[model samples]
Target: MTKKLRNAPAYIFLTIFAVFSVFPLYFMMVSATNTSQEVLGSKLLPGTNLLENFNNLVAQQDLGSALYHSAVNAILTTVLSLIFCSFAGYGFEIYHSKGKDRLMAVLLLAMMIPFAATMIPLFQLFAQNGLINSTAAVILPTISTPFLILLFRQASRNFPHEILEAARLDGLSEIAIFARIYLPTMRATYAAAAVITFMAAWNNFLWPKVILVDSAYQTMPMLISNFSSGYVTDYGALMLAVLIASLPAMVIFLVLQRAFAEGITGAIK
Candidate 1:
């Protein structure tokens, strides 16, 4: 009884925190299912207007194209980043040199510069090249992230050099070894990278907003922003759009959750 009493405060704090964190998500889901009129009320329960809300949002503005563009940008960026960053990471770790190390240090330092500072130059360069208002603009800037390269470098340290030597002795080329051997061994790391890259690409707003001036090329996030704008807002439709927009990131995380956890553990260890 005394021990239980001692732990009561801790349990109470945890429970309260959990409720606070979960309530907003619960409210979003509930609101997404309610009518515009019903959403204005102070009800915590879900209503039977999910289809209606979705239809209303679709009717007012087409999210289908936005979703597709977002997917393309996110998937392409994730895949390319994994390839480039992983290759760079593996090279840096396996073939270290003082000059290369200094160059890498410079690149790491470059990451410290805020994106806002670089945005104007990036926009000017793209505009000069006639790439403004293109989805390529959204994707090109994110093709390789320095943080991901660092992640890959750290993870590559755990790889066995003996396996690499054995493959070389067997006359396997460097490209073959990396693709057939190194990549297979780093599944967890890649999974984690995929989750992070996909989430960032999916949720990226400022760069996309500034670069993509055409309404035709607007992404899901842009659509959500516009929904909240205009004199009157459709609360239920906006909530539904948010829920839909959030689904891809949530699904990607859930699918790769196990590997994601394992990757973090491996990186830490």
Candidate 2:
């Protein structure tokens, strides 16, 4: 009884924190079901306007194309990032040469340079190549990040070298060993990377906005931005759009959260 009493304050604090953390999401959902006026009035409960908001959103925006574009860009970026970064990471750790270490240091240094600093040059290069407004332009800059490479490299440190030797002795090619052994062994790491890469790619707005000049290639973020852009913004429909846009990343994280935790903690197996 005494111990329970001692922990009561802590529990109360935690409950309050949890409520505060969840309230934004709850408000977003509730606002989605409200009229624009009601949403502006900060109505906290679900209302009867969800269907109306959906109708308005559909009428006003090209939701389908936005969803398709965002999905393709994010999925491609995540897939390519995983493949390229994982290979780079595996090589860096397994090979372990002084030259590679210096190269890695250079890559790590590159991460310090903000994306904003490089956007103009990237835009110019893409323009010169006639690649502006293309999916390739949207995806190319993000498919291999220093951060992802570092993540995979760190994860690779936990992989067993003896397994590699055994696989090699068994006449497996390097690619075969990576495909058959290292990949399965690092499932958690991959899950974590996939979640991270997918979320980043999905939420990316600035680069895509700059690169995809054509409105037809608008992504979900751009669509959401357009919703909130005008003199007469439909707050309810805007909330609904945001709610929909947020779903994929949330789902990916929830599904991989356990593995994400394990991978972040460098847990092998």
lDDT of each structure? 0.91, 0.95
Error of 1 at 88 (Å): 0.6
Model 1 misplaced regions, further than 4 Å: 1-8
User: In every candidate, how many clashes are there?
Assistant: 0, 0
Estimate candidate 2's alpha-carbon lDDT, on a 0 to 1 scale.
Answer: 0.95
TM-score of each: 0.95, 0.98
Q: Candidate 2 versus the native: TM-score? A: 0.98
Question: Which stretches of candidate 2 lie above 4 Å from their native place?
Answer: 267-269
For candidate 2, the 10 contiguous residues with the lowest summed lDDT are: 260-269
Candidate 2 C-alpha lDDT tens digits along 1-269: 99999999999999999999999999999999999999999999999999999999999999999999999999999999999999999999998999998999999999999999999999999999999889999999999988888888999998999999999999999999999999999888899999999999999999999999989999999999988999999999999999999999999999999999988788333
Against the true structure, what is every candidate's RMSD? 1.6, 1.3
